[model samples]
Target: MAEDVQINWGKVKNIFESVTERMGQNPDRPAIGAPKAKVRVIKERLFEAKAEGHTFQIDEPVERGGNGLAPSPMAYFTAGAAACLTSHITQSAGFLETHYTSLEVEATVLWDNRRKFSIADLAQASLGIIYNIHMESDEPEDKLIALLKHAEDGCYASDVVRNETPLRAHLIVNGDEMYVHKNGAEIPDVPAGPTFGDNPTGMSKDEIAAKKRDGG
Candidate 1:
C-alpha cells in the first residue's frame, strides 16, 4: 500500500464494469438478460448522466454565448481519460515498484461530423497520457517501452472504444429515484431551482428530475 504501484494493468480491467454495473431485473423470476448499465441524456448536452454516478456535463465558453460558468462537458473527456490512465499507472507502478513524478493525460475530441459538429457525433476517447515516470533509479529504453505498453494495454476504455461495443441507453424524461423501478410511481416538479435552469437550494435536482422528469 505504498504510493508507488506497478501491477498487471489488465488486472484493473474488471474495475470499470464493476463500478458501472446496473441492477438487472428478472421479470420472469428465473429470466435472464444482459448486465449492462444505463445512460440518459438528462438535458441536451447540458448533462448526460446515469445511475452509475458518472456525469458528463456539456459546458460552453463565454465566446460560445453560454455563461461560461461551467466547464465544457468534453473536458470531462480528459478527466475520464486521466482517471483511467491514473488507474493503470497506479496499478502498474505498484507492481513494478516504480512511480511517476507527474502524470498528464490529454484527450482531443476529433470532430469528423461534416454534416453537423454535434457533440454526440464527435468522438470521445483517451488520446494519450504522459507519465513523468521512472524507477527508483534510471531504467533502459526497452524496459520503459515495456512499461508503457503495459499501461496502454491496461486501458480498458481504450479497448472498448477501439472495438466498438453494443450501446444501449434508456432515456427517462422524468424518472424518480425514490421509485426508480416502481411502476405508476412518479415524482412531482416543484418550482424551478434558485436561478434560471438551476436546481433548488437544498435539493438534488438530478434526484428531483429523475423523479419529476423521468418519473419513478
Candidate 2:
C-alpha cells in the first residue's frame, strides 16, 4: 500500500518560529539606514495603519492616553516585518538568480492584552510573506526559498523587538532646547542627532538648525 503524503503547515510554521523568531539583532542598537526625509507607507496593517501624505503614522494606544489615532507597537512589528521582507526579496532575488515578480508580507498580530499598543502580554500569532514569483526561470524553488531564508536571516528590525534586542538612547537638553550630537567630528561628516517636533519643548526648527551650524 502506498502511503499518502501530507505537508503539515503547523510543522513548517513551528520551524520558522523556532529558528528565525529566536535570532535577535546581530548588533544591538546597530546603526540602520535612515531616510533624509519621510517616505509614505504604501501599505497598511489590518486597517489599523494607513499612509497619509507621506508619513508613517505614530500614535499612542487608547490605554496610554492616546485617542487610538494610530496603530500600536504590534502593528509596527507587522509593518516593519512586511517592509523588510519586500525590500529583501527585491534586492536579493535577482542576485540569487531567481525570477521574482512581486512580494507582499502580511502579518496578523494578536496581542494578548486588554491595553492597546501595549507590549506586555503581547504576541505575534501570524507571520509570513507571500512571494509572487517567476519561478519558471532557471532557478529551482528550493534555491529561491533558500535565498529567502538567508535574506530573512539578515532582517534585524523583525528580530529586534521580537527577540528583545538591547537598546538605549540618551538625550541632553539645555533650557528645553534639545542637544545635538557632539563626537568631535567634522562638519558635513558628523552624524545627525535626533529630530524634534516643529515647536518642540523649546526652540523652533530654525533655531535648532542654527544651533547645529554653530556646533551648539
Candidate 3:
C-alpha cells in the first residue's frame, strides 16, 4: 500500500513555487554554512572526533601500529561521500515528486599505497583514492539518471572528492590530496549476467523489486 500511494503533487508544486519566490526576493537571506568537525588525538594513531554533538572514534589498523579498534579515517571519508550522495539523490527525488519502493547507495574506494613510505608522502601518495558509486532504486531509468546527475552536481562530499575545494596543511589539521582515476581496461563493459528485475543499472537479486512490475 505504501508503494502504491502517490506522491503529494500539490505539496510538491507549492514547495517549488515557494522556494523559487523566496530565492528571487531574498537571495542573500538564506546563507548556508559548511559543517565543521573537530578531532582530538586519543593515543597513537587513534583520535576522537565531534561534530554537532555526535562523537566517533578513528583509528588505524593493527598492522599500522594501531589497536584496530575503530574504522580508519579513510573508511569514514569513503562513507561520508556515499552518505552525502545518497542524501542528495533522495532530496532530488523528493523535489521531483518521485516515488520509489527502495533506494540504496554503495561506495567503494580504490586506494593505491605504493608511494606510502612515510607521513610526508601522505599528501601525494594518497592522492590516488578512487571512488566507485553504485546506487539501486526502484524508479524509472530516466528519472533515476536525472536524480543521480543532480546529486553528482550538488553533493558537497563529491565536490570535495573531486578536489574542487582549497586545501592547506597545518599543524592542527593535515592536508591530503585525492583524485579519481578511471581506467577502461580495469572496468567491465557490461553486466556479468542478466539485469536484476528491480534495478536495471546494477542491483543484486535480493534487492527490492519494482512496485509495479514492468517489462525488463
Best by TM-score: 3
| Overall lDDT per candidate, in order of appearance | 0.48, 0.49, 0.63
Q: Residues 1-216, candidate 2: write the lDDT tens digits.
A: 223323333443443444333333333432333334332333342133334225455555667655566776556666766777656554455445554433445545443343444544444423334333232335676887787786677665555545534433335466564645453333232245643211223455698789779865
Task: Give the Å shift of residue 18 in candidate 3.
Answer: 5.8
Candidate 1 segments whose C-alpha is farther than 4 A from its true place: 1-58, 117-137, 173-216
Between the candidate structures 1 and 2, which one is better when assessed by TM-score?
1
- Off-target runs (Cα >4 Å) in candidate 2 are 1-56, 59-73, 114-139, 169-216
Query: Between 1 and 3, whose TM-score is larger?
Result: 3
- Listing every candidate in turn, what is its Cα RMSD in Å to the true structure after a full C-alpha superposition? 14.1, 16.2, 15.6
Q: In lDDT terms, how accurate is model 1?
A: 0.48
Stretches of model 3 off by over 4 angstroms after superposition: 1-23, 28-32, 118-138, 169-216
**Which TM-score value belongs to model 3?**
0.61
For model 3, the local distance difference test gives 0.63
What is the full ranking by lDDT, best candidate first? Answer: 3, 2, 1
